[model samples]
Target: MIAVILMLSRGSHSRSHKLKSRALICSVLLWMSTAVMTRSSSTSDLKSKISGVEELLEEFRKQLQQDESGSREDEEDGDRCISGFKAAEERIIRASASIEQGAAFLSAPQRVFSWRDCAHACCSHPHCTAAIIQEDLKQPDDSLRCYLFNCTYRGRSVCSFSFQPGFSTYSRVNNSSRPHEPGRGSTATDSPSLDEPPRSDAGQDLVVQLPTDWAVLDGRDSTDDHDIIHYEWALVKGDPSVKMKVTHPGLLKLSGLREGIYTFELTVTDTSGQKSSDNVSVSVLAPAPNAEGQKLFVYIFLDYF
Candidate 1:
C-alpha cells in the first residue's frame, strides 16, 4: 500500500508538468502572431502614405504643364499691344531725339537675343508705336528692356533729352496710311488743316448720383470766334446709341439712371457746320450696404429743417 501511494504521487506530478509546458508553447505562438500582424499593418500604412504623396506630386506636375502650355499659346498668338498703335511697320530710328520720358507704358525687361528680336516684338503688337531697347550691361548679352510709346503730335517720340548710351529707339512708321504733310513731306492728303475737327474736353471719366443728377456739357471753339453755336449730347456706351435729354445752356440733368457705366458724347458745331466730338465716361456706383440707414437719417434731418 505504501509503494502504490508513492507511484500515484509521481504520476500526478508528471501530468502537471506536461500541462504547464503546453500553456507556455500556446503563449509564445500567440505573441509571435501579434507581432507579425503589427508589422504588416505598419508596412501597409507606410505604403498608403507614399502612394498619396506620389499622386499629389503627379497632379502638381500636370498643373504646371498646363500653365506652361497656355503661356506658350499666348506667346504664339502675339497679343501684345503698345501705345494703341496696330499693324504698323517697324522702322529703325537710330539715335532719335526723344529719350527718357514720353512712353505711355513701359514694359518689363524682356530677354532678347539681339536688337532685331526687340524690333520684331514691337512690330507684332497692334498698340506698339515705338520701342526702345535698353541694354543691361551687368547681365548677359541677351538681357534687354523694350519700352513702348505712342508718337505724340509733337516731333518728340519720348522726351527732349539727347541720345543715351546703351539705348536705341525704333519707331513704327505707317507709310501706306499716314497722312502726309504738304510742306514737310512729299505727298499731302486732300484734307485741309482748317477742316481739322475742333478739340473738346472729353475722354474723361465721371461719377454722379444715381436715379437723378445734374451734369454740364460745355463746348468751346478753338478759334474763339463765337462760332460754336450748336451742341448735341449723345450716349455711346450705355444702352447703345441713346440720346441724352438736354437742358438749356449746356446743362445736363441726368435722370432715370441705374447703377452702371455710361458714356456721354458731345459734338459742337461751328458756323461753318463743322462738327467736333468728344466722349466722357460716367460710372454709377452701387449703393453702399449702409446707404438705407444714412438715407433715413438725411430724410429725418431734412424734414426737421
Candidate 2:
C-alpha cells in the first residue's frame, strides 16, 4: 500500500520534505478545511484520524530527539509538517524493525485503584497513543488486558515484543486515525473506554419552587461499558459538596444538592493500560411543575463535569 502511495506522491523525498515545512505553516487552515470536507468518515474513522494526529506529534517528538552530534538534526530538519501517510509509514517501519531485532514486551502497569488509575497513564504517555488488551493465545478475550505501545518504523510487532512476551497478545483501545476534533478523543471504536457524555440540561427549571441540586454518585453505565460514571465534584464557589444555590442533579434524598447545572465525571484505566475520562453535565431543578402557572425562578449555576 505504501509503495503504491509513494509512487503516487508527486515529488521526491527532498522536494516533499521541503513542502512538509510549508504544510506546518498552513496546518490550521488545512485542519479546518479537512474537517469541513471529511465529515463523512465514520465515527471510528474520525477517531482514527485524531489518534493519528496525536501519534504523529508523539513520533515527531521522538524523531526530533537528538544525540550530541549534529548529523541527525540535519537529516530530519528537512521535514517538519507531519503527513498522515508519513506517520503511517513510520509505524510500518518500526513494526518491521521490531520483528527483526528482539522486542521487549511490557506488562500493563498495575496500581490502578479504579478505571481512572489506568486512564491517566495512557493519556500521559506519548508513545502510548492507543491501548490493547494482552491475551493468552489459547483464551484470547478471556486473557488479561494490557497496554499497546506505539510501534516504530523499524520494529515489527513480533520482533519488538518477542522478548517481553507481554505486549505480544493485545488489542487497541484507541483509534489510530488522523486528527479532526481538537477538544475530543476517541476512547476505542466499541470498547468500553471512558468518554464524556452529552451534557444534559433538562433538569434545570424555574418550577422547582424550592432550591435544588443533583449529581451522579458513583454512576454506572447502562451496560457498564458507556453507562457507569465515577465522578469527583466540588461547589467551586460554595461548599465543597454543594452550594445552597440551584443546580443540576438537584436535591438528592440524602444530601442537600439543588436547582442549577451540575457536572459529573468518571475516569477509567483499562486492563490494556489505556485510560480515559468522562465529563458530563446533568440538568437539575425542581421536578417539572404539577401544573403550568408556577412562578419560575431562574438561577445561574456554574458547574463542571
Best by lDDT: 1
Q: How do the residues 1-305 of candidate 1 rate in per-residue lDDT, one tens digit apiece?
A: 34544444455556677576556555666777788899999999999999999999999999999999888765544322222233223333332443223233425437776556666666554335566677777776657776655443222334332346666665554411132222232321343322222334453467766444434444332232235667777777775433356676444556655677888877777676766667778777765567789899999999998
Model 1 ranges with Cα > 4 A deviation: 1-13, 77-127, 132-147, 151-305
Per-residue C-alpha lDDT of model 2 across residues 169-266, encoded as one tens digit per residue: 22222323122222233333543433322121222222222344433343232112233232223333223455333232222221455555555433
Model 2's TM-score against the true structure: 0.23
Residue 277 deviation, candidate 2, in Å? Answer: 2.7
> Number of clashes in every candidate structure?
5, 68
Per-residue error at 137 for model 2, in Å?
53
Model 1: colliding residue pairs? 82-127, 82-128, 85-126, 85-127, 86-126
User: Where is model 2 more than 4 Å wrong at Cα?
Assistant: 1-239, 243-254, 271-275, 287-305
- lDDT assessment of candidate 1: 0.55
